[model samples]
Target: MNFQKPKVKAPSYELIHKTKNIIDKYSVNTICIESACPNISECFSRNSATFLILGDICTRKCKFCNVKHGKPNIVDSSEPKRVANAINELGLKYVVITSVDRDDLSDYGVSQYVKVTKEIKKINKNIKIELLTPDFHAKKELMDKIINSNPYKLSHNIETVESLYKNIMPGCSYKRSLKVLEYYAKTGILTKSSIMVGLGEKKEELIKTFYDLFNCGVKQISIGQYLSPSFKHHLVIKYYNKKEFDELKEIALDIGFDSVQSGILVRSSYYADKM
Candidate 1:
Protein backbone atom coordinates (compact mmCIF):
# COMPACT_ATOMS: atom_id res chain seq x y z
CA MET A 1 0.00 0.00 0.00
CA ASN A 2 3.02 2.24 0.16
CA PHE A 3 3.98 2.33 -3.52
CA GLN A 4 6.03 5.33 -4.63
CA LYS A 5 4.46 7.90 -6.86
CA PRO A 6 5.72 8.10 -10.44
CA LYS A 7 8.34 10.73 -11.27
CA VAL A 8 6.14 12.92 -13.43
CA LYS A 9 6.50 16.68 -13.41
CA ALA A 10 4.38 18.76 -11.04
CA PRO A 11 0.99 19.93 -12.29
CA SER A 12 0.47 23.56 -13.23
CA TYR A 13 -1.79 25.03 -10.56
CA GLU A 14 -2.85 27.90 -12.86
CA LEU A 15 -4.05 25.52 -15.55
CA ILE A 16 -5.67 23.25 -12.99
CA HIS A 17 -7.55 26.22 -11.54
CA LYS A 18 -8.73 27.31 -14.98
CA THR A 19 -9.93 23.80 -15.77
CA LYS A 20 -11.76 23.58 -12.44
CA ASN A 21 -13.42 26.96 -13.13
CA ILE A 22 -14.64 25.82 -16.53
CA ILE A 23 -16.02 22.59 -15.07
CA ASP A 24 -17.72 24.52 -12.24
CA LYS A 25 -19.04 27.30 -14.50
CA TYR A 26 -20.74 24.75 -16.71
CA SER A 27 -21.86 22.79 -13.64
CA VAL A 28 -20.35 19.63 -15.07
CA ASN A 29 -18.30 16.75 -13.63
CA THR A 30 -15.16 15.53 -15.36
CA ILE A 31 -13.36 12.22 -14.87
CA CYS A 32 -10.12 14.19 -15.01
CA ILE A 33 -10.88 15.85 -11.68
CA GLU A 34 -13.05 13.15 -10.17
CA SER A 35 -10.54 10.32 -10.65
CA ALA A 36 -7.58 12.54 -9.78
CA CYS A 37 -6.07 11.52 -13.09
CA PRO A 38 -2.28 11.84 -13.33
CA ASN A 39 -2.64 13.47 -16.76
CA ILE A 40 -4.93 16.21 -15.46
CA SER A 41 -2.37 18.99 -15.94
CA GLU A 42 -1.65 18.02 -19.53
CA CYS A 43 -5.25 17.37 -20.51
CA PHE A 44 -6.56 20.49 -18.74
CA SER A 45 -3.79 22.62 -20.22
CA ARG A 46 -5.06 21.56 -23.62
CA ASN A 47 -8.68 22.30 -22.62
CA SER A 48 -9.77 18.69 -22.90
CA ALA A 49 -11.76 16.69 -20.36
CA THR A 50 -13.83 13.53 -20.26
CA PHE A 51 -17.25 14.57 -18.99
CA LEU A 52 -18.70 12.26 -16.33
CA ILE A 53 -22.47 12.30 -16.71
CA LEU A 54 -25.38 10.58 -14.96
CA GLY A 55 -24.12 11.74 -11.56
CA ASP A 56 -20.92 10.75 -9.77
CA ILE A 57 -22.42 8.00 -7.65
CA CYS A 58 -22.01 4.49 -9.02
CA THR A 59 -24.15 1.43 -8.31
CA ARG A 60 -21.31 -1.10 -8.20
CA LYS A 61 -18.39 -0.99 -5.79
CA CYS A 62 -15.40 -1.87 -7.91
CA LYS A 63 -12.34 -2.33 -5.72
CA PHE A 64 -9.98 -0.36 -8.00
CA CYS A 65 -12.21 2.52 -9.03
CA ASN A 66 -12.17 6.00 -7.57
CA VAL A 67 -15.86 6.66 -8.31
CA LYS A 68 -18.14 6.69 -5.29
CA HIS A 69 -20.37 3.67 -4.84
CA GLY A 70 -23.80 4.10 -3.25
CA LYS A 71 -27.28 5.34 -4.00
CA PRO A 72 -27.12 8.04 -6.68
CA ASN A 73 -29.07 11.27 -6.97
CA ILE A 74 -32.11 11.72 -9.17
CA VAL A 75 -31.33 11.90 -12.88
CA ASP A 76 -30.55 15.41 -14.16
CA SER A 77 -32.54 16.19 -17.30
CA SER A 78 -30.40 19.24 -18.20
CA GLU A 79 -27.04 17.43 -18.18
CA PRO A 80 -26.88 16.81 -21.93
CA LYS A 81 -27.20 20.49 -22.85
CA ARG A 82 -24.63 21.45 -20.23
CA VAL A 83 -22.17 18.93 -21.66
CA ALA A 84 -22.71 20.17 -25.20
CA ASN A 85 -22.37 23.79 -24.13
CA ALA A 86 -19.21 23.08 -22.19
CA ILE A 87 -17.68 21.28 -25.15
CA ASN A 88 -18.61 24.20 -27.39
CA GLU A 89 -17.18 26.76 -25.00
CA LEU A 90 -13.94 24.84 -24.76
CA GLY A 91 -13.74 24.75 -28.58
CA LEU A 92 -12.96 21.05 -28.49
CA LYS A 93 -13.27 19.41 -31.87
CA TYR A 94 -13.11 16.02 -30.19
CA VAL A 95 -14.72 15.25 -26.83
CA VAL A 96 -15.13 12.26 -24.53
CA ILE A 97 -18.33 11.66 -22.56
CA THR A 98 -18.51 9.00 -19.82
CA SER A 99 -20.63 8.21 -16.79
CA VAL A 100 -20.88 6.24 -13.57
CA ASP A 101 -22.76 2.95 -13.56
CA ARG A 102 -26.41 3.90 -13.09
CA ASP A 103 -27.73 0.41 -12.58
CA ASP A 104 -30.68 1.97 -10.75
CA LEU A 105 -32.05 3.18 -14.07
CA SER A 106 -33.88 0.69 -16.23
CA ASP A 107 -31.68 1.48 -19.23
CA TYR A 108 -28.56 1.61 -17.06
CA GLY A 109 -28.10 5.26 -18.09
CA VAL A 110 -28.16 4.53 -21.83
CA SER A 111 -30.80 7.19 -22.45
CA GLN A 112 -28.55 9.84 -20.98
CA TYR A 113 -25.73 8.83 -23.31
CA VAL A 114 -28.02 8.90 -26.31
CA LYS A 115 -29.28 12.34 -25.40
CA VAL A 116 -25.81 13.73 -24.82
CA THR A 117 -24.44 12.31 -28.06
CA LYS A 118 -27.41 13.67 -30.00
CA GLU A 119 -27.09 17.09 -28.39
CA ILE A 120 -23.41 17.28 -29.14
CA LYS A 121 -23.98 16.29 -32.76
CA LYS A 122 -26.84 18.74 -33.10
CA ILE A 123 -24.82 21.62 -31.72
CA ASN A 124 -21.65 20.87 -33.65
CA LYS A 125 -22.04 18.56 -36.57
CA ASN A 126 -18.32 18.40 -37.21
CA ILE A 127 -17.26 17.62 -33.66
CA LYS A 128 -16.27 14.01 -33.04
CA ILE A 129 -17.49 12.19 -29.92
CA GLU A 130 -15.99 9.22 -28.09
CA LEU A 131 -18.19 7.72 -25.41
CA LEU A 132 -16.67 5.67 -22.57
CA THR A 133 -19.72 3.86 -21.25
CA PRO A 134 -20.70 1.27 -18.69
CA ASP A 135 -21.72 -2.27 -19.73
CA PHE A 136 -25.46 -1.66 -19.34
CA HIS A 137 -25.36 -5.19 -17.95
CA ALA A 138 -25.02 -6.29 -21.59
CA LYS A 139 -28.67 -5.54 -22.29
CA LYS A 140 -29.42 -5.60 -26.02
CA GLU A 141 -31.82 -2.65 -25.89
CA LEU A 142 -29.39 -0.41 -24.02
CA MET A 143 -26.52 -1.32 -26.32
CA ASP A 144 -28.77 -0.58 -29.27
CA LYS A 145 -29.47 2.87 -27.89
CA ILE A 146 -25.75 3.66 -27.74
CA ILE A 147 -25.10 2.35 -31.27
CA ASN A 148 -28.03 4.33 -32.60
CA SER A 149 -26.54 7.55 -31.20
CA ASN A 150 -23.65 7.10 -33.68
CA PRO A 151 -20.71 8.34 -31.66
CA TYR A 152 -17.39 8.32 -33.55
CA LYS A 153 -16.23 5.66 -31.11
CA LEU A 154 -17.89 3.71 -28.26
CA SER A 155 -15.62 2.39 -25.48
CA HIS A 156 -16.10 0.38 -22.30
CA ASN A 157 -13.17 -0.46 -20.10
CA ILE A 158 -12.65 -4.12 -19.23
CA GLU A 159 -10.67 -2.76 -16.20
CA THR A 160 -8.74 -5.95 -15.50
CA VAL A 161 -8.09 -9.51 -16.58
CA GLU A 162 -10.84 -12.12 -16.49
CA SER A 163 -9.41 -14.22 -13.66
CA LEU A 164 -9.45 -11.26 -11.29
CA TYR A 165 -12.89 -9.90 -12.13
CA LYS A 166 -14.79 -11.53 -9.30
CA ASN A 167 -12.49 -10.16 -6.63
CA ILE A 168 -11.36 -6.90 -8.27
CA MET A 169 -14.59 -5.82 -9.96
CA PRO A 170 -17.13 -7.81 -7.93
CA GLY A 171 -20.50 -7.30 -9.61
CA CYS A 172 -18.99 -7.07 -13.09
CA SER A 173 -18.72 -10.04 -15.44
CA TYR A 174 -15.68 -10.39 -17.69
CA LYS A 175 -17.50 -12.39 -20.33
CA ARG A 176 -20.33 -9.88 -20.39
CA SER A 177 -17.85 -7.07 -20.96
CA LEU A 178 -16.50 -8.92 -23.98
CA LYS A 179 -20.03 -9.38 -25.26
CA VAL A 180 -20.57 -5.66 -24.99
CA LEU A 181 -17.54 -5.02 -27.19
CA GLU A 182 -18.65 -7.72 -29.62
CA TYR A 183 -22.12 -6.22 -29.82
CA TYR A 184 -20.77 -2.77 -30.52
CA ALA A 185 -18.37 -4.16 -33.12
CA LYS A 186 -21.18 -5.88 -35.01
CA THR A 187 -22.79 -2.46 -35.53
CA GLY A 188 -19.86 -1.38 -37.77
CA ILE A 189 -19.19 1.66 -35.56
CA LEU A 190 -15.68 1.88 -34.10
CA THR A 191 -15.60 -0.19 -30.93
CA LYS A 192 -13.01 0.18 -28.14
CA SER A 193 -12.12 -1.16 -24.67
CA SER A 194 -9.42 -0.59 -22.05
CA ILE A 195 -7.64 -2.64 -19.37
CA MET A 196 -5.26 -2.01 -16.49
CA VAL A 197 -2.08 -3.96 -15.74
CA GLY A 198 -0.11 -4.53 -12.47
CA LEU A 199 -3.03 -6.25 -10.84
CA GLY A 200 -1.13 -9.49 -10.11
CA GLU A 201 -1.85 -10.78 -13.60
CA LYS A 202 0.74 -12.78 -15.48
CA LYS A 203 2.02 -11.88 -18.95
CA GLU A 204 0.34 -14.89 -20.48
CA GLU A 205 -2.94 -13.95 -18.88
CA LEU A 206 -2.64 -10.46 -20.27
CA ILE A 207 -1.91 -11.86 -23.71
CA LYS A 208 -4.94 -14.08 -23.53
CA THR A 209 -7.08 -11.09 -22.59
CA PHE A 210 -5.76 -9.24 -25.62
CA TYR A 211 -6.69 -12.16 -27.86
CA ASP A 212 -10.12 -12.31 -26.26
CA LEU A 213 -10.78 -8.66 -27.05
CA PHE A 214 -9.38 -8.86 -30.59
CA ASN A 215 -11.46 -11.94 -31.36
CA CYS A 216 -14.50 -10.09 -30.04
CA GLY A 217 -13.97 -7.44 -32.77
CA VAL A 218 -12.60 -4.67 -30.60
CA LYS A 219 -10.78 -2.23 -32.86
CA GLN A 220 -9.00 -0.04 -30.31
CA ILE A 221 -7.58 -0.81 -26.86
CA SER A 222 -5.85 0.99 -24.00
CA ILE A 223 -3.55 -0.62 -21.45
CA GLY A 224 -2.26 1.23 -18.40
CA GLN A 225 -0.67 0.73 -15.00
CA TYR A 226 -3.22 0.47 -12.18
CA LEU A 227 -2.43 2.87 -9.36
CA SER A 228 -4.59 2.35 -6.30
CA PRO A 229 -6.71 5.46 -5.74
CA SER A 230 -6.54 5.21 -1.95
CA PHE A 231 -5.41 2.93 0.83
CA LYS A 232 -8.84 1.43 1.07
CA HIS A 233 -8.80 0.47 -2.63
CA HIS A 234 -7.00 -2.48 -4.24
CA LEU A 235 -3.26 -2.40 -3.76
CA VAL A 236 -0.91 -2.26 -6.74
CA ILE A 237 0.55 -5.72 -7.11
CA LYS A 238 3.34 -4.43 -9.33
CA TYR A 239 4.28 -1.48 -11.55
CA TYR A 240 5.04 -2.24 -15.18
CA ASN A 241 7.84 -0.04 -16.44
CA LYS A 242 7.69 2.01 -19.66
CA LYS A 243 9.38 -0.73 -21.67
CA GLU A 244 6.84 -3.28 -20.48
CA PHE A 245 4.02 -1.00 -21.59
CA ASP A 246 5.69 -0.61 -24.98
CA GLU A 247 5.95 -4.39 -25.32
CA LEU A 248 2.30 -4.81 -24.43
CA LYS A 249 1.30 -2.24 -27.02
CA GLU A 250 3.22 -4.12 -29.67
CA ILE A 251 1.64 -7.38 -28.60
CA ALA A 252 -1.83 -5.85 -28.74
CA LEU A 253 -1.21 -4.41 -32.20
CA ASP A 254 -0.04 -7.82 -33.40
CA ILE A 255 -3.24 -9.29 -32.02
CA GLY A 256 -5.03 -7.10 -34.63
CA PHE A 257 -6.12 -4.07 -32.62
CA ASP A 258 -6.19 -1.12 -35.03
CA SER A 259 -4.84 1.26 -32.38
CA VAL A 260 -3.32 0.77 -28.95
CA GLN A 261 -2.45 3.27 -26.23
CA SER A 262 -0.38 1.74 -23.45
CA GLY A 263 1.52 3.56 -20.73
CA ILE A 264 1.77 4.17 -17.02
CA LEU A 265 -0.74 7.03 -16.97
CA VAL A 266 -2.94 5.97 -19.87
CA ARG A 267 -6.48 5.85 -18.60
CA SER A 268 -9.34 4.69 -20.80
CA SER A 269 -10.17 8.27 -21.84
CA TYR A 270 -6.63 9.57 -21.97
CA TYR A 271 -5.80 11.12 -25.34
CA ALA A 272 -8.89 9.31 -26.59
CA ASP A 273 -9.31 11.57 -29.61
CA LYS A 274 -5.85 10.78 -30.89
CA MET A 275 -6.99 7.39 -32.10
Candidate 2:
Protein backbone atom coordinates (compact mmCIF):
# COMPACT_ATOMS: atom_id res chain seq x y z
CA MET A 1 0.00 0.00 0.00
CA ASN A 2 1.28 3.45 -0.96
CA PHE A 3 1.01 6.35 1.52
CA GLN A 4 1.18 10.04 0.77
CA LYS A 5 4.03 12.07 2.19
CA PRO A 6 3.01 14.59 4.85
CA LYS A 7 3.39 18.30 4.17
CA VAL A 8 5.80 20.49 6.12
CA LYS A 9 5.40 24.25 6.47
CA ALA A 10 7.93 26.46 4.73
CA PRO A 11 10.60 28.06 6.89
CA SER A 12 11.32 31.78 7.11
CA TYR A 13 13.94 32.75 4.56
CA GLU A 14 15.34 35.67 6.62
CA LEU A 15 15.81 33.55 9.74
CA ILE A 16 17.42 30.72 7.84
CA HIS A 17 19.86 33.09 6.14
CA LYS A 18 20.84 34.68 9.44
CA THR A 19 21.43 31.29 11.04
CA LYS A 20 23.52 30.12 8.11
CA ASN A 21 25.69 33.22 8.32
CA ILE A 22 26.48 32.55 11.96
CA ILE A 23 27.29 28.90 11.23
CA ASP A 24 29.58 29.98 8.43
CA LYS A 25 31.25 32.60 10.59
CA TYR A 26 32.37 29.93 13.02
CA SER A 27 33.42 27.46 10.34
CA VAL A 28 31.70 24.61 12.15
CA ASN A 29 29.65 21.65 10.89
CA THR A 30 26.07 20.64 11.53
CA ILE A 31 24.37 17.30 10.97
CA CYS A 32 21.44 19.32 9.66
CA ILE A 33 23.32 20.44 6.57
CA GLU A 34 25.77 17.53 6.26
CA SER A 35 22.99 14.92 6.25
CA ALA A 36 20.60 17.11 4.23
CA CYS A 37 17.96 16.91 6.92
CA PRO A 38 14.43 17.54 5.67
CA ASN A 39 13.82 19.92 8.58
CA ILE A 40 16.92 22.03 7.90
CA SER A 41 15.03 25.13 6.81
CA GLU A 42 12.71 24.98 9.80
CA CYS A 43 15.54 24.40 12.27
CA PHE A 44 17.77 27.06 10.73
CA SER A 45 14.90 29.53 10.67
CA ARG A 46 14.53 29.02 14.42
CA ASN A 47 18.27 29.70 14.88
CA SER A 48 18.63 26.20 16.24
CA ALA A 49 20.92 23.43 15.10
CA THR A 50 22.53 20.24 16.31
CA PHE A 51 26.28 20.85 16.19
CA LEU A 52 28.29 18.19 14.38
CA ILE A 53 31.62 18.16 16.14
CA LEU A 54 34.87 16.35 15.30
CA GLY A 55 34.50 16.41 11.51
CA ASP A 56 31.92 15.63 8.86
CA ILE A 57 33.50 12.38 7.67
CA CYS A 58 32.31 9.15 9.28
CA THR A 59 34.21 5.90 9.79
CA ARG A 60 31.35 3.49 9.17
CA LYS A 61 29.18 3.31 6.06
CA CYS A 62 25.73 2.68 7.50
CA LYS A 63 23.44 1.98 4.57
CA PHE A 64 20.79 4.41 5.79
CA CYS A 65 23.01 7.32 6.75
CA ASN A 66 23.80 10.29 4.51
CA VAL A 67 26.95 11.34 6.41
CA LYS A 68 29.97 10.66 4.21
CA HIS A 69 32.02 7.62 5.19
CA GLY A 70 35.76 7.15 4.77
CA LYS A 71 38.94 8.23 6.53
CA PRO A 72 37.94 11.32 8.58
CA ASN A 73 39.98 14.44 9.22
CA ILE A 74 42.23 14.76 12.24
CA VAL A 75 40.48 15.91 15.45
CA ASP A 76 40.22 19.72 15.44
CA SER A 77 41.21 20.84 18.92
CA SER A 78 39.53 24.23 18.36
CA GLU A 79 36.14 22.76 17.37
CA PRO A 80 34.69 22.66 20.88
CA LYS A 81 35.17 26.37 21.51
CA ARG A 82 33.88 27.28 18.07
CA VAL A 83 30.73 25.24 18.57
CA ALA A 84 30.20 26.87 21.95
CA ASN A 85 30.69 30.30 20.41
CA ALA A 86 28.13 29.54 17.73
CA ILE A 87 25.55 28.54 20.34
CA ASN A 88 26.27 31.64 22.37
CA GLU A 89 25.89 33.91 19.36
CA LEU A 90 22.62 32.22 18.46
CA GLY A 91 21.38 32.87 22.00
CA LEU A 92 20.27 29.32 22.41
CA LYS A 93 19.12 28.07 25.81
CA TYR A 94 19.30 24.44 24.72
CA VAL A 95 21.75 22.70 22.42
CA VAL A 96 22.37 19.26 20.95
CA ILE A 97 25.87 18.05 20.03
CA THR A 98 26.67 15.04 17.84
CA SER A 99 29.66 13.80 15.87
CA VAL A 100 30.50 11.61 12.93
CA ASP A 101 31.51 8.06 13.88
CA ARG A 102 35.22 8.51 14.52
CA ASP A 103 36.08 4.88 15.08
CA ASP A 104 39.55 5.88 13.93
CA LEU A 105 40.23 7.61 17.24
CA SER A 106 41.69 5.82 20.23
CA ASP A 107 38.83 6.76 22.58
CA TYR A 108 36.41 6.81 19.66
CA GLY A 109 36.25 10.61 20.03
CA VAL A 110 34.74 10.46 23.53
CA SER A 111 36.94 13.28 24.86
CA GLN A 112 35.61 15.66 22.21
CA TYR A 113 32.06 15.19 23.49
CA VAL A 114 33.22 15.93 27.02
CA LYS A 115 35.13 19.00 25.88
CA VAL A 116 32.18 20.34 23.88
CA THR A 117 29.78 19.82 26.76
CA LYS A 118 32.10 21.54 29.21
CA GLU A 119 32.76 24.43 26.84
CA ILE A 120 29.05 24.98 26.27
CA LYS A 121 28.43 24.92 30.00
CA LYS A 122 31.27 27.28 30.59
CA ILE A 123 29.53 29.87 28.45
CA ASN A 124 26.10 29.39 29.99
CA LYS A 125 25.85 27.23 33.05
CA ASN A 126 22.06 26.96 32.84
CA ILE A 127 21.88 25.95 29.21
CA LYS A 128 20.85 22.34 28.68
CA ILE A 129 23.22 20.28 26.53
CA GLU A 130 22.30 16.96 24.97
CA LEU A 131 24.84 14.60 23.40
CA LEU A 132 23.75 12.24 20.59
CA THR A 133 26.68 9.88 20.28
CA PRO A 134 28.18 6.87 18.56
CA ASP A 135 27.98 3.57 20.50
CA PHE A 136 31.74 3.55 21.31
CA HIS A 137 31.51 -0.24 21.16
CA ALA A 138 29.60 -0.05 24.47
CA LYS A 139 32.79 0.32 26.51
CA LYS A 140 32.06 1.24 30.14
CA GLU A 141 35.24 3.27 30.72
CA LEU A 142 34.59 5.38 27.65
CA MET A 143 30.95 5.84 28.59
CA ASP A 144 31.99 6.81 32.11
CA LYS A 145 33.88 9.81 30.72
CA ILE A 146 30.73 11.07 28.96
CA ILE A 147 28.60 10.36 32.04
CA ASN A 148 31.00 12.47 34.09
CA SER A 149 30.57 15.36 31.65
CA ASN A 150 27.02 15.67 33.04
CA PRO A 151 25.17 16.36 29.85
CA TYR A 152 21.47 17.13 30.12
CA LYS A 153 20.68 13.94 28.18
CA LEU A 154 22.71 11.23 26.41
CA SER A 155 21.38 9.55 23.24
CA HIS A 156 22.55 6.69 21.04
CA ASN A 157 20.14 5.74 18.28
CA ILE A 158 19.27 2.08 17.78
CA GLU A 159 18.34 3.16 14.20
CA THR A 160 16.38 0.02 13.24
CA VAL A 161 15.15 -3.36 14.42
CA GLU A 162 17.46 -6.31 15.06
CA SER A 163 16.35 -8.29 11.99
CA LEU A 164 17.49 -5.39 9.79
CA TYR A 165 20.82 -4.72 11.52
CA LYS A 166 23.06 -6.84 9.30
CA ASN A 167 21.80 -5.26 6.10
CA ILE A 168 21.14 -1.71 7.31
CA MET A 169 23.85 -1.03 9.91
CA PRO A 170 26.84 -3.19 9.12
CA GLY A 171 29.66 -3.23 11.75
CA CYS A 172 27.11 -2.17 14.39
CA SER A 173 25.68 -4.52 16.99
CA TYR A 174 22.07 -4.31 18.16
CA LYS A 175 22.90 -5.84 21.54
CA ARG A 176 25.82 -3.45 22.00
CA SER A 177 23.63 -0.45 21.26
CA LEU A 178 21.27 -1.57 24.00
CA LYS A 179 24.18 -1.98 26.37
CA VAL A 180 25.20 1.64 25.65
CA LEU A 181 21.80 3.00 26.60
CA GLU A 182 21.52 0.65 29.57
CA TYR A 183 24.84 1.86 30.97
CA TYR A 184 23.79 5.51 30.93
CA ALA A 185 20.35 4.74 32.32
CA LYS A 186 21.77 2.72 35.20
CA THR A 187 23.89 5.73 36.13
CA GLY A 188 20.71 7.86 36.43
CA ILE A 189 21.37 9.76 33.22
CA LEU A 190 18.44 10.66 30.97
CA THR A 191 19.17 8.17 28.19
CA LYS A 192 17.34 8.09 24.84
CA SER A 193 17.22 6.29 21.46
CA SER A 194 15.45 6.53 18.06
CA ILE A 195 14.18 4.19 15.31
CA MET A 196 13.42 4.62 11.62
CA VAL A 197 10.43 2.86 10.09
CA GLY A 198 9.72 2.00 6.42
CA LEU A 199 12.71 -0.30 6.11
CA GLY A 200 10.55 -3.39 5.56
CA GLU A 201 10.28 -4.11 9.26
CA LYS A 202 7.32 -6.09 10.57
CA LYS A 203 5.06 -4.29 13.04
CA GLU A 204 5.81 -6.98 15.61
CA GLU A 205 9.54 -6.41 15.13
CA LEU A 206 9.17 -2.69 15.87
CA ILE A 207 7.21 -3.43 19.02
CA LYS A 208 9.88 -5.87 20.12
CA THR A 209 12.59 -3.28 19.46
CA PHE A 210 10.64 -0.76 21.50
CA TYR A 211 10.40 -3.22 24.38
CA ASP A 212 14.09 -3.94 24.12
CA LEU A 213 14.90 -0.22 24.38
CA PHE A 214 12.50 0.32 27.26
CA ASN A 215 13.81 -2.70 29.12
CA CYS A 216 17.32 -1.34 28.80
CA GLY A 217 16.14 1.98 30.35
CA VAL A 218 15.52 4.39 27.48
CA LYS A 219 13.20 7.05 28.82
CA GLN A 220 12.75 8.92 25.54
CA ILE A 221 12.21 7.62 22.02
CA SER A 222 11.46 8.90 18.52
CA ILE A 223 10.10 6.99 15.52
CA GLY A 224 10.16 8.41 12.03
CA GLN A 225 9.55 7.33 8.44
CA TYR A 226 12.64 6.38 6.46
CA LEU A 227 13.28 8.37 3.31
CA SER A 228 16.07 7.18 1.05
CA PRO A 229 18.91 9.71 0.77
CA SER A 230 19.78 8.72 -2.76
CA PHE A 231 19.28 5.95 -5.30
CA LYS A 232 22.41 4.35 -3.88
CA HIS A 233 21.13 4.34 -0.30
CA HIS A 234 18.69 1.94 1.27
CA LEU A 235 15.35 1.90 -0.52
CA VAL A 236 12.31 3.04 1.39
CA ILE A 237 10.09 -0.01 1.55
CA LYS A 238 7.17 1.89 3.12
CA TYR A 239 5.88 5.38 3.93
CA TYR A 240 3.99 5.29 7.20
CA ASN A 241 0.91 7.46 7.43
CA LYS A 242 -0.28 9.73 10.22
CA LYS A 243 -2.42 7.04 11.76
CA GLU A 244 0.46 4.59 11.82
CA PHE A 245 2.79 7.13 13.44
CA ASP A 246 0.19 7.85 16.11
CA GLU A 247 -0.21 4.15 16.75
CA LEU A 248 3.54 3.79 17.26
CA LYS A 249 3.60 6.73 19.65
CA GLU A 250 0.74 5.25 21.66
CA ILE A 251 2.50 1.91 21.84
CA ALA A 252 5.76 3.52 22.95
CA LEU A 253 3.97 5.51 25.65
CA ASP A 254 2.09 2.48 26.90
CA ILE A 255 5.37 0.65 27.19
CA GLY A 256 6.53 3.33 29.70
CA PHE A 257 8.58 5.75 27.58
CA ASP A 258 8.36 9.09 29.36
CA SER A 259 8.50 11.04 26.12
CA VAL A 260 7.73 9.95 22.54
CA GLN A 261 7.89 11.71 19.19
CA SER A 262 6.58 9.64 16.25
CA GLY A 263 5.75 11.03 12.85
CA ILE A 264 6.61 11.13 9.16
CA LEU A 265 9.28 13.87 9.31
CA VAL A 266 10.72 13.06 12.72
CA ARG A 267 14.49 12.56 13.07
CA SER A 268 16.44 11.69 16.19
CA SER A 269 17.45 15.30 16.84
CA TYR A 270 14.58 17.04 15.05
CA TYR A 271 13.00 19.51 17.46
CA ALA A 272 15.11 17.84 20.13
CA ASP A 273 14.83 20.67 22.63
CA LYS A 274 11.05 20.48 22.62
CA MET A 275 11.08 16.70 22.90
Q: Which candidate is the best by TM-score?
A: 2
Model 2's number of clashes is 0
Name the top lDDT candidate: 2
- lDDT by residue for model 1 (29-74), tens: 9988778788888888878899999999889999988888899999
Please provide, for model 2 over 1-275, each residue's C-alpha lDDT reduced to its tens digit, 9 standing for 90 to 100: 77876777898888988899999999999999999888898888888899999899999989989999999989999999999999999999889899999899999999999998989989999999989999999899999999999998999999999999998899899999999999989989898899999999999999999999999999999999998999999999988989999999999999999999999999999888987
Clashing pairs in 2: none
Reference-based TM-score of each model: 0.96, 0.98
For all candidates, the clash counts are 0, 0
- Show model 1 residue runs off by greater than 4 Å: 1-5, 9-14
As a TM-score, model 1 comes out at 0.96
